[model samples]
Target: MLLGGLLGGALDLLYAFGFAASRGVAPTRLLQTIASGLQGQAAYEGGTASAALGLFSHFAMSLAWAAGFALLASRVGWLRQRPAFAGPLYGIVVFLAMRCVVLPLSAYPHPVGFPPLSTSLDLLSHMFLFGLPIALLVARALRR
Candidate 1:
């Protein structure tokens, strides 16, 4: 679970950071945005402290996702047998749950909207970078 979460979280953050950089957004600002999930708009004004909190929150969420997947995969044989297929699908699931359910229920200050280009990229990143690594790592570890 640790391995999967760490790898998946790191990859997810890297993709996010790269994407933000391409659009001229600083990593600190991105982190602050994440912190806003829990701290609301005040996170943006909290500077480095909020950014750190956001980073911690990101990893915590990743780990929770990893642990949940690991638990389910351990009991579900098909998941272990089909890492590549299951992983991407799981990523999609994660994305949907976060965007549709989680965010709506969280302390996020803004309403979530699906703005085509960014939404597509975000979905692809979750599938390929976040979910894929977690599923693959968990499958490998459990099979041993």
Candidate 2:
């Protein structure tokens, strides 16, 4: 389980880094941008502290997500048997939950100039950057 969680979290971090690379944006900058959007004024006021907190929070969230995936895979026969597809499926579920449920409920202020195209890009980015890799990793672990 620990191995699976570590692998999942590592893959997520790698995917996030890759996403930043593809966008020609520094990961720190991208995170800062996101933090700003999420936290409003304090995101910029505290600068390094805000970014650090945001990054640490993200890391912790990733670890928890990985752990949850590991636990679910262990308890769910279907997930264990078909991790490849299941992993991606799990990602999709999370994506939908965030987009349709979580974000809507939280009502966080979106950045100005964030248009529909950007929204689509963000969704696709999450799918490939976070979802796909997690799914693949989970699938691989389940295979064994």
Candidate 3:
């Protein structure tokens, strides 16, 4: 689960940076925004430290979601039996958990305000880049 989280988080961060850059948003600002979830907007002013924190926070969140799925997969035989299908669905679950619960209650930019295209892209990324990797990795662990 830890390995899946780390790799998936790194992959997701890369995808996020590219997505944000294409939209005229600075990558550093995006990283800072991750930290903002915990430190509020002031995290942007924190410079390198805040970016570091953001990176850490991002991985922590990924790890948590991965752990959650791993726990469930371990306990639920049906889930372990169908990674290809369940993975993307779990990604959607992770996305909703963040947008509806995690981000809403956090201090990050309010309302999320993702454009239609961006929103779709984010959802796809979560499914393929985030949740799928975690699911596949955890599934592999189960096989072992």
Model 2 lDDT tens row, 8-123: 55555566667678879777765564465357556756677767765765656556666677678778887767665666677666657766765455424553343586566655
Question: In candidate 3, what are the lDDT values of residues 15-113, reduced to their tens digit?
Answer: 999988988988778889999999997998999899889988999989998999999999988777888877889999998888888898999765776
Better of 1 and 3 by lDDT: 1
Candidate 1, residue 120: CA error in Å?
A: 0.8
Which candidate has the top score in lDDT? 1
C-alpha lDDT of candidate 1 relative to the true structure: 0.93
List, in order, the clash count of every candidate structure. 0, 4, 0
Name the candidate, 1 or 2, with the larger TM-score value.
1
Q: Single out the weakest 10-residue window by summed lDDT for candidate 3.
A: 107-116
Q: How close is candidate 3 to the true structure, as a TM-score?
A: 0.95
lDDT of each: 0.93, 0.61, 0.89
* Full candidate order by lDDT, most accurate first: 1, 3, 2
> What is the Å distance of residue 82 in model 2 from its true position?
0.9
- The TM-score of candidate 1 is 0.97
Q: Could you tell me how far off, in angstroms, the CA of residue 40 lies in candidate 1 after the best superposition?
A: 0.1
